[model samples]
Target: MQIVKYLKQYRIPFSGLAAGKHNFEFEIDDKFFDCYEHSLIKKGQLKADVEMQKQENMLIVNFHITGVIQLTCDVCLSEFESPLDFHERALVKFTDEDWNQDTEEVLVLSKTDYELDIAGLLYEYANVRVPYYSKCAEQGMNQSCDPEMLAKLSSEAADAEEDNTEEQIDPRWDILKNIKNN
Candidate 1:
């Protein structure tokens, strides 16, 4: 599909590189997230700096990703930008085996493969950095929840509590109370 072709820029062709350190860079934006169907991060402006060290049989890749991602505040339901800076390392091993084994930090590639597609790895790295509970006050710089929204929520809660107190009780409970008083 068109989406898959768009992400091909992340592939690194290491077959011809010498056994030394190599550097590559990529820009991540909203369109990058669109390639994924269910991406946690919808929008961001990030730069991925990759340093790959190629050896005789393996490659060690270090990723330095930095940028700001748009996140919705859980407390106030407002949109805000949260800065992201993270480092992750991945090991790619070349093997002749028929079966391919891959993990979060390790990858096994067939000897015949000439390029390593890193779009998925980059997506994973960016998504994992998001907090489980996102709040503007905590994640964003000098940011806080919306005062008007908080006030409206508190007022609605108070009104609900008042309505509950005005509800009529069963007459049997009152009879039981009177008997207990006696």
Candidate 2:
């Protein structure tokens, strides 16, 4: 697991600082995922970065990330890469005293005291950035899609759909089939 040594150095320098903005970056790799037992997200590399503005007592954070997760298709259940990208921001306030955090977006830390553990923040940012509905592209949508797989999947789906409609009104459907009789 690669820790952000740069940010840790910033914490040491925070003692010498007035208020200012800072930037941080990270390159996520397979070893990073292995640390969390997150084997499900394998094969794809990710990049994450953040900008934090420190103004007197308030901290405004902006995050940007991009990556891909190898996922199984919903229809054919075949493995495919799903691309992801994300952006978000949050406000943090330094308080003279500790206060219970009500929302995940906001953080309030004791002013007389310490620093933020951006490890968790970075992890959360990457996870939340991914879309919930990510799926493999359709037959012609993705040009390189396997032809044999697409044909089998399309035929199976069409068969199921036909069966469903047929089961819904097979008897009355026969009546409609003779529409020209009477």
Candidate 3:
């Protein structure tokens, strides 16, 4: 059985349970990331805990995602690990008619089957927990960033801005050299 299928078994009974709070937990690791193709993550240690309260025809799922998501640095595009820490909530309602919704947090279920599989829900919440952009702290800024690359960029910009007099200009920029000093 697939890891996600674990939720399918509890569908009917859990849905019919009296209005109360229920809890579920999941562990995320490198193996989970490998399942996805071209995953940006190389390694991960995430924990997802969901608390749900059943009320009449609706279920409120509170997803708490926290841990470390091993991903490359966005700035330097180098392998780096960013911490994951966030919380999100969602509501699932059972309706007779399929209502088109405009949000990720609201879900409608069929009249026949009121049960919902939280695997997809967990995946989405985990994704949302990750910060869209994480910058390297000053201490770690240059750690992943290639020193040579930064040096090259610095030198190029410096050379462009310098007061390149005709005497200082390289032969290659003869036109530019004459425009300034001559």
Candidate 4:
């Protein structure tokens, strides 16, 4: 895919790594998110630190993610930057036969494979950590939302609630209500 070119740097060649820990660092910017056609992250600046521990049979990779991303607030429709920090670990093993993994944190690759493509894992891990309802940072602290939009939305919601409070009885349900009263 065309996106592969942008993520090529995230590949780690594990065949030559010594049986020890190796560290790699990456800076994720706006261009990184451009690789994905549909993504909630419109703009971002993030730092990724990967620690790879290689053993004779298995590999352990730990990712530390920290940064800020610009997101559209669901409540106010305003864009704001939110801080991010998360840690993810993956266990990878060499396999002789092709198989699908049922585990979320484990991966199996062919013995002949030279490098591991970590871009997909990093992308998933990062996205899953984002809050579903993004709101302005100030709103979370009880400061304020977008004044004009908030006021309009508040008025509409109040009207809807008031309308719902005056309930109309269906003819079928009215008979049941009379029976209950009797």
Per-model TM-score versus the true fold: 0.91, 0.63, 0.66, 0.80
Q: Residue by residue across 1-182, what tens digits does model 4's lDDT show? A: 76788899989998888899999998887888888777667688889999999988788999999988877788888777778888999999988887787389899888898898888887777778678887785423343468999899999999988776655534666677899988
lDDT values, one for every candidate: 0.93, 0.64, 0.66, 0.82
Q: Point to the candidate with the largest lDDT.
A: 1
Which of the predicted structures, 3 or 4, would earn the higher lDDT when compared with the native? 4
| TM-score computed on alpha carbons, candidate 1 | 0.91
> Cα lDDT of model 1 overall?
0.93
A best-first ranking of the candidates according to their TM-score comes to: 1, 4, 3, 2
lDDT of each residue in 1-182, candidate 1, tens digit only: 98989999999999999999999999999999999989999999999999999999999999999999999998889999999999999999988987555887889998999999999999999999999999999999789999999999899999998877765454676777799888
Off by over 4 Å in 4: 138-143, 156-182
**Which run of 10 residues does model 4 get worst, by summed lDDT?**
136-145
Count of clashes, each model: 0, 0, 0, 0
Evaluated against the true structure, the overall lDDT of model 2 is 0.64
> What lDDT does candidate 4 reach at residue 141?
34
